[model samples]
Target: MAKAFASQGDMSEKKTSFTEIGEGLYAFTAEGDPNSGVIIGDDSVMIIEAQATPRLAQKVIDCVRSVTDKPISHVVLTHYHAVRVLGASAFGADQIIMSDKARAMVVERGQEDWDSEFQRFPRLFEGHESIPGLTWPTTTFSDSMTVYLGKRKVVIKQIGRAHTAGDSVIWVPDQQTMFTGDIVEYHSACYCGDGHYEDWGATLDAVKAYDPQSIAPGRGDALVGRDMVDAALTNTRDFVDSTYNAVKPVAARGGSLKDAWDAVRDACDPKFRDYAIYEHCLPFNVARAYDEARGIDTPRIWTAQRDLEMWEQLQG
Candidate 1:
């Protein structure tokens, strides 16, 4: 019989693949791990989302080096997750950029999130010690910022709060390709522990408005072609909606967290059971959804101890 439950710590295996998604654009996804995006321009390069550690980011650097010797002058943080931003030092990019809100999140919860995530997923942080403290953004924007990669335009915008309070997406208008950090996920489960469910749907709608021909999501494989792009957006929206709606009524009834978890699992498991990280994210997703349903505007901080306590309450 197949195993029914696995710890988050057990799924940290890394997978590295550099796939060319468009002209001068590539996606480096590590088997369900945090992904990094590469934008090769006329004279320089910009990397979106540094991996968890210097060692991991170095692997991506090696791949980028294979194509061009142009220096990586910019590193863009789509959000301030430890797994994504801690490796900024590895790129040695002169300017590390982020949305204004993302930088604030780092100041507010950077240390807590760092401690929480390192404990939960060890393998992702292959060289945790090499991470020289928390990553700080050198530049930040409120709504949108347009960067020129030696004449190639890459627009970075804070579409809305979906995955985190300060989520941003990088759009390559000429190529009709967008690199959405955690705002959009394909195949892999959406991590909603620090997300805003109501805002997430609106953000997805905004992404759809761009009509991207290709999208490199925060995780899973890159979506190519219009059909595939639409499918990815649709599936992500559906997952978020279904999960939120399933737990809303239970939360409204003032039901136990366990009850809400069961409600969401019953509704989502049939179709999403085989999806990557579905089982692992369900408990946390339901917890957040339940909190949101009760008019909790902000997601409570998730500490390492809180993670285990919540897991036991819902999964036990």
Candidate 2:
């Protein structure tokens, strides 16, 4: 398993696809990797979740070119993860929008996260050198904000902290479509290294409240139709809930971190075993769950070295 971290074992690249979930709304998905959302209004364009680097993001831009010529006016980051925000500079949008909480995280751990994430998944950093620096949001909202793309409307809000300190999603009320950054994963693992598990469940409840017809998730494919959208959200909720459920008892009883990890793996791996990144995310997810279960309300920042140390501890 440690070796699994060292190498992805010749996993080939995935073919990218741009699917229209709503009128003039597109989801740029590349199978198991990170996905991006696109919204084209009469006057401009809005992109959700920038890729790892400018060169990598250019691929999404190229796909965008195939559809619309409207200027990319806004780049909205759902959270402050490095892989999701580093490419903001590439779009050169009029405004880089994000939640105020996410901005605070970027200010605190953006650099460490950049290094940590790049080391964990270097393939995503195709044009690392092209990134000017950490992506700083040009505009930030404390909780929610709405902007008009011509007559089209997009509501961006931080529903609650889930995958990160400030997880947000974009809603197109008229289209009944939502762009969820890392808050929802269909066929992918929910990385809980920086997640808030308890709040995450309530957060998923908040997501369901919107009743999105088509949802563009952070990874995996875009969920189309009510059934698929519900399945995605349910899967997300199950994963988060199960993580907490499996680890809480052990943690509350003062079990070792390894014990909690093993318990979670046993409880969750059987169900989510085949999902993308499941193996890679198990250790980190359990660690965070264990902390939260033991009453650690806030998540600890993970550095590259810290990641390795944690992996070694669990693997050893």
Candidate 3:
């Protein structure tokens, strides 16, 4: 039988875990589901990566309420993906911030992404109807921006691109803890459909410079110790590096996309096959890597229709 398309078979909900990785820092993660980070500053709170919809986001809000009474002042998007940004409205945050590139991506392909991702993972979009259309940023920054919730400092920076063109990571200078959006994943598959594979390695180098004592990645469990953080970073890099290395040569040899996909899947499976979303991400991962290797600098927008078409043409 032919393989199913992206996430069509992944409708079951995984258990959600909310962990405090550091003092005032929380990670709201579901087993393999998209995760969000919470930061409590002096007098206010900031949420990183909103869940998919208002109803779902309310669950995160409830979690926040249980711990801190500080109002959610900002909803920071580490990147522009429907699963990551659409739940912003639910937070009632005064400011919604994203890297300028990420905001631009919303204007360019927000609707298409909303539709594409919803169709791909119906389970994650449980409150789909509650979404108030495409989520927009109240503020945007280029290289980096800092916001203070009272006296605490939250640094947000666009550290190259890995998951998407306009990816950003939140750094807490004093604590030396970082919330690296999709740029760095832990024991979970990295979705490279909208990624910049060649530049991704360099971006990881930037993430390493922060030397975060703890890290809240875009998905999976939070990395709690410096050693664990480093391991996750290295593991993430290896995933991206292996994908590019396996596919780059296939493109260089003018091999078929299938050849590139098979090569990468075969090479990466031994290490990453058990990781979350590995199967769902493989086709898109290979497709994007092949494009990068063949000199396509930018990633193409993935529409719901295109997703299925790509699956049939490649995975099928």
- The model with the greatest lDDT is 3
* Candidate with best TM-score: 3
Q: Tell me the lDDT of model 3 at 53.
A: 93
* TM-scores, all models, native as reference: 0.96, 0.97, 0.98
> Could you tell which candidate, 1 or 2, scores higher by lDDT?
2
Give model 1's TM-score versus the native structure: 0.96
Model 1 lDDT per residue over 3-42, tens place = 3335444654556889899999999987677889999988
Clashing pairs in 1: 15-30
Q: Pairs clashing in candidate 3?
A: none
Count residue pairs with overlapping backbones in model 2.
Answer: 0
Q: Which lDDT tens digits does candidate 3 get at residues 54-133?
A: 98899899999999998999999998899999989999999999988999999999999999988888888987899988
Output the worst ten-in-a-row residue range by lDDT, candidate 1.
Answer: 1-10
Q: Candidate 1 local accuracy as lDDT?
A: 0.89
Off by over 4 Å in 3: none
Local distance difference test scores for all models: 0.89, 0.89, 0.90
